[model samples]
Target: MASKHDIPLTGSSVNIVKKCGPALNDILNSKFGCGATFSGVDFERDLSIAHQKSSYVGPDRRFGVTLHSGVEVSVWKADLTNLSVDAVVNAANTDLQHVGGLAWALSKAGGPQIQRDSDDHIRKNGPLLTGEAIISAPGKLPCKNIIHAVGPQLTDPSYISSAEPFLEKAINSILDRVKTNKLNTVAIPAISSGLFNYPLPQCANTIVKTVKRYYEGVFFNIGHIPKEILLVNHDDLTVQEMERACREILAPHLAVPNSQTTARKTRSAAKTSTPTVQIANVCLTLMKGRIEDQPTDVIVNTASPDLKLSTGEISKALLQKAGPEIQNAIKNTPPKGYVIRTPSYKLPCKEVYHTRCTDRGAHGAEKVLWKSVSDCLWLTAASFYKSIAFPAIGTGNLKFTRKESARILLDAVNQFAQNSTQKMNVYFVIFPSDHGTFQAFEEQMKWLQAPRGPTPEASEKRDPFPNTRTPPPQISLTGPSIESLFEADKWLGHLFKSSGTIEIYNNFIQHFSHNDYVQLSRLQQNGVSVEEFFTAGHACITLNGPSDEVAVAALQVEAMLCSVQKDFVAEEEGEMLLLSSAGNNVPFERKRVDRSTQEFKDKAAAFHKQGLRISKLDKVENSTLQLLFNLKKNQLQCHATEEMFQRVPAQFCEMVSHVGFHAEFAPPEDPAYGEGIYFASTAKKAMEVWKGKREEYLYFVEAEVLTGSSVPGRRGLFLPPALGTEPLRVHDSVSGGSDISVIFSGYQALPKYIITCQK
Candidate 1:
């Protein structure tokens, strides 16, 4: 709690706040119930200042950029009536009645003349159809003219199917109005996305892409006429989406395809964008999306102390997807702590954690928030969950400002990253409509990523490795003070040592001679690898070599997880270098890459990016390049295992050893942990699970199981659950409490010793 209250804004944070203008002076003189303080170990005050700095972008806060075609596209969250554009586009219904949503607000600002003009247009032209538009003179509004465009209503199920095409037409109609009136500037809201039930991302993409394409003369004759077109919305989420759409659509070496071709274009892209910030092995990200769609191991919600989902949009959506079991569980359970955990019955995620704050900003809201967030993260990591997604949930009543809540959420993650040593992916998902909170988080991330001068060694220049496009992003927060930072560099020297060596690699990272960026998590397998976390953010992963060397070559082992789910994914990162047990000749650079086909060149280039050797001698003729590679199979041996199971059919008792299903006497398949080999914490627990009248030679293997990112072990499961966000990658193993450790794949575990007992 002390850590939650008296928090310091690192040396870099202090440097940032000292530069704030009058806001600094105002905070210094201001008086409040809790008393705010910035850069003076006050989390709340520093957060407020951060919000102010992020929100204020000069006098007008114009978030705009000029395109290559000299068309200035400005996207910002603001009142349309306040912006003095030549023409403003209104998202109107068929009858053009400005009664609800943004339409009413615009009409209220413009007075009764707008309604009268709309009525006149409808009477003269008989109710305007969807995708149609009618122009009207500005009546007390800031803009010179108004383009009342009829956008498709997405809420209607019958019209939902035709919404996209109609929405496109509506945008084109607005642009046509611009051309007809020769308007130099226009502001358009995200049509059909308000109460009309259209999605924000699609709405934004459609509008921005259409505008860009229209300017490029993709649409009949609607070429770039207006010097500036503003994609203004009242909410920051929509504005941010527009900005993102603009960047992605206009990036260099980029081509945006229509909806029909989107599938093909998206599939070719291998990697998505990186997290906002990466600390040690933890990646903290901010996503603008619905929590229900977030693919994480756990979905965290701020709930009542009794563990009930509130009647909010996010909660309703999740409840609807998960069925009524969650609500039913709440009725049966007693009052819990700040946090409670539940299994996701029908939801995409494995589990759900709910926390309570009750009061957000009244008094000591920071402590309550800190506990909720910290506990959720700690619990998730403890359960070996890889990822967790959190929505902007707060004080039972949604009375707190988005900025306050945003700051608290980020602060919690920051604290966790500072102290955590686990490799975790944490996502703070904001619904696309909450702009203020999104911007707050975006600003905090920018400040957090600021270079804190942790290591002066980062300033040094290093020789570039061959064939790597860019170096992997890894920073030494505390420099390489440990003696065993890169143990892989010294492995060759210790290979032939005929004894069990006790070499310690605090951080087992392999630096590829060809490319320093290529990281190999596992060098070998068979020994124990311990994991620990402290206040200092550092994670240690150790690997032990195979036992075929007649001596213990390595103490720690990094196990390679095998899964049937990853059939489509490549087994290795790229062209893997095989290490043979027997001494063999190093591969010679003699093989020439065939240059006749473009396909061969593309394959060679792709392999080159993954640090595969491709040498071209200066004196070589015919533009020949030599490739040095000798890929061999890496296999693991399975030891004899024995276990008991309930009486069942022979097919159910059958086991898979290495290749496929065989009639081998392996451990019985247990669905409690995905039908895998279950290991008890002790022999007593093993006996309790599988004891029978004929149990005499009772035993279990004390193997080094690779529990990468596990989910709860439930009945009827065949394989380990898929990794959070990656449906193709399954968890290395499944876990079930203090009694059992379920190894889904034989390759994921190595039998170290056997515990035999007689009952």
Candidate 2:
């Protein structure tokens, strides 16, 4: 190690001396940006010791996005050791040896405890795979915990293909630790970007993307996670890359204009070669290419019984291309029936429809396949997407023949195309390497054109009606001769009007229990043909009539289908509710304050300066007071009752910890603000936000909330609406009427401390 005297008085070192008087000797002695050691000071040290006691970062940016729950995701150029978060993530290898790079720096600062705990952990659990992670107790470091995650190395073969998945695993493992341990904030370096030989930009992108993806799940799932995620790095390049990635991947959306979203062809694709045919209003096309690369509104990915995307070759490929973010999305919001819908990460498509057809036996195999394929189409239409690309599903590990699977799957598509009263482009994409599957699908596509029902020419030829005169049937009606002629003429008209038949497969079974029979009877009374049948273990509903009547009936049937789906989702939510309320269900940390510490005096002063007398500060670590622990956290909030501010992102906070989403996203009784949870920028504002109708009984929640870009708000708005008349961008939040801010999503805010005070 370099001697203390060898250190230079650089900008940060010089500033340290100026801010902290009479610490010249200590400031000149310590090394800065050295990965092997960190002073592990609190974030407030931004104002404190350098002997120059500098925190891990050099000034760069918090360039990040605040999620729905008030979680702040920031990227900074700083040393990892300087951060005083609840936990710091260490990029480690399999053996738990802290020999070099970030591992050495963290181990050095944290002292021998890290090594000892790591060795013991590895000794008991064995070596970790590239994506696996383990947690270690902090030794001498300022943070309370450490998470050790293994990332991929360039030395491994086909690391490109393997790296994304492994890297994602490593990132997720770290996040999982944060969630399980209930760490309010976690600092993570770019894993694999050091000596592991992973490319810096890709490594940073994957990490940022995974973090964003994880938060997305938190928003959807109401899962408990850290309030803040810090992407801390000592070097400028890595930090820059991290910032770039966060900006690109987590950039907030602007209100988009209503523009046509047409499917664009890949540069390499030959438009003339794709086999296509029209079925009613839909264009059925067969293309041989990678399903993940198709630029469609939605693409299909086959999953296993567990609904994990990594279990099959096709799904594994999609997951790899999509990165681990997809996995995070999958685990948080499980599949309802045969399919789970997630926003696609790295894939070209907008959404990935993960379908499971795990019935290995022949008995119910076709039924499941029908459900999987039909579900994808049904969801595609429901989302109002004009196009969807599906992979050849029946063939791979499920072991069905290419021909049989193609025919069965396409049969579902053919059925959907005929029934849907909307314009759609349906694509069956075969993997480029799988020539046989392409041939099977291609042949089936031609057969789809051959005839699903009798054509006009074929019908005329079969009946000999157009070319030859039909023999007049003897009409025996108790009326005049004209009546007999009319009855004879009406017989031909019945044969001439063709029935528009639509067949639906794999009912959710519960639909029958809920007005489906009554609804079907209503259709019959309205002159729409309806039939219900059972195949394998599932129920089927078919509707037939004139095109317009069938179309109308189709709308009602779609509603029933949606109701059936609601049952599965609603059931899952009920289970989550039960799991959210007990011990360890929601994670918050509390430690009694040491009122004797000098730091407490300073924080108390900061608090008193805000025009409020603290009856008490319930919890404190030594002398410091911090309300934001990562959830783009602010200091603290004072609850209000009966006042205008009493209503927060009204009900959003109530739905924390799988404590999922509020029906209206506004404050409890006030939806006038933007549709999001509320946060205040200052201590005074925080006090105002939570100050209740009464003063004696007071409650405050210290939280990390990410309130990024904001604009003024009005009541009754659900999400941050578009900011301008021309741009497609929407504000991340709205400045609340109560001198506060409101964010739409729950994931952006993480509740850290709950302090009760008496006035």
Candidate 3:
């Protein structure tokens, strides 16, 4: 219902009279219904003529406001093409053709150059897909560049719900380009509202909301985003609609207080004297410093699967202090999601427990984080260590946010404390530089200290230690029996059963050590002294008796093995049990060895030593030739013209060729003679020629020839037959008039077996 006159004009609005002068007052009044009286002029006709001759030069200012994130957003009723900004957005079709209302206007004002560039882009990359955008140099427009954003066509009823996401994509694509190109300001049209028929209000809401969210989300990373985002439209009605949408949608978000301020206020209001959780025999303390400096009974090191001890700052520092012995002990160990104990060495702590934790953003990162912490506690408890220090496991280079890392870590420690019978002191050691991490832990501590109500029955049932020695009433594992394990009592019983524990350990070792000698060596090196069972089928090992050095070494070895096993399982599955002793100290390094060339050399030498004439041919030509070597018959047959037979060696010229060589000769010393010679033999013998040296053999031909020319002629071996030991029937015409023939048989280069044959 609001008219142009009703809209409030800001102080920046350009006065029409100031621009047009007194002569055009009568003309403006007649055309735009303005009724302003001049001091002394009644020249209405002259004013009308003057107004017709003049044109407006500047932007049509409407309304603008600065959002809470310090981004300037404006609603302007003016031609977008005329606005001088870094770029202007065009609501475009997926084809990127400038055919619609705004698109056509932009194309016209910008000249044919814009359309030509868009057409060229379409030709090269096909049509631009929906919810995507591309930039083009503005032709004659005031803006430097034009961003063509493709939104979903709302013509289909099914696409209604998807409009918001499409609009969001369009807005984000433009913003991304702006940031990438370091553009300061941009003007965007009311996208998808005209012939696209998207409702104006919804479109406006989407645009404003998307912009506000972008600024708010990236506020921390980029202090200054786009300096100004102008929502421009030539139509007055569209401008008014956008302004209204901005007030209703964006204003609320701006008015709300920042989240950090809100959190502080909430904490102050909930302040209390009593602690949030009070356990029987455990204490939780937060300390800020290097984990190595913490004087706990043991410290947990966040490590990778390779056990290189060179990833995070904490890891590097620990490794430097722990010395090379710790690295050497655990180098062969696989890194599973379990704790590995190693000697603290020069460290302040008595021992070190290492575990691999994933990035916070990865799948099941929370579960893995919890398991790492829990395993460390369980190992500490079993080893009879009263205190353990834990560094923020995944918070370092793993990119786990401080808040999430703290929450998961604290929850794990709290759960462990609630059920442990022995008194334990848990220290959360944080780096001095990570203030946010320290604050997160501090907040958690405050929350834990706040007074709470009675403990829930569900939580009480989750005891860290349940009686594991008691046997089940019977040993039946049928459907009902298996289903019964889901029950609380039965499940607890199943966890403690000696048979179950052994089965789990067997399975764990079998799966981890199968075909993996490194992991097997790690397990064997870290001798399994005693297996400590826990709730939920979790188990860890300790030294056979009470030797600290042996215990630390074993734990480190097992932890390394577990890490490697996890990586191998992620790759593929097999069941080849290969166990090796960790004490062997033989480093297993895998390298690629090519033996094909060597195999060829050995084969060539053997042929020579056995007194066979090796005639290296550079070229051979024949047609309708048949060379058949029958392995079962132990004979060679040839069918060819007399000229072809005469051209070949007299030893192989007979109609029925013999298996043995006609002349005695040593292996050829020249490289040319060595490479091209082929030995006539059975398929079985030929296949075995390169058995252990297949990779080094370079000769391409491996087929059993049935017909046609097999030799490469006097020039050289043109191309070895197909690269396989399988017998094949080959028939082809040759350019030469003469036809040559030889018995078909498997061939091998002598170099493959020269060393072995000579020995």
Q: So what's the TM-score on candidate 1? A: 0.31
Off by over 4 Å in 2: 1-272, 359-362, 451-759
TM-score of every prediction relative to native: 0.31, 0.28, 0.27
lDDT of 3 by residue, 265-323 (tens): 54333232112233433567776678878888999998885677876778899988878
User: How well does model 3 score by local distance difference test?
Assistant: 0.51
Summarize candidate 2's per-residue lDDT along 598-706 as a digit string, tens digits: 7456545755676544443334231111222222232112122111111222112222222332322223333356445666655566555544454333344445555
The models' CA-based lDDT, in order, is 0.52, 0.59, 0.51
Task: Show where candidate 3 strays beyond 4 Å.
Answer: 1-58, 156-158, 222-224, 252-759
In candidate 3, position 601 carries an lDDT of 50
Q: What's the alpha carbon RMSD for model 3?
A: 33.5
Give the lowest summed-lDDT range of ten residues in model 3. Answer: 747-756
**Regarding TM-score, does 2 or 3 come out ahead?**
2
Summing lDDT over every window of 10 consecutive residues in candidate 1, give the lowest-scoring window: 617-626
| Candidate 1 C-alpha lDDT tens digits along 199-310 | 7778788888887777775544555478998888754456657767877775523434433343453411312322256553367888777898778999987665444565
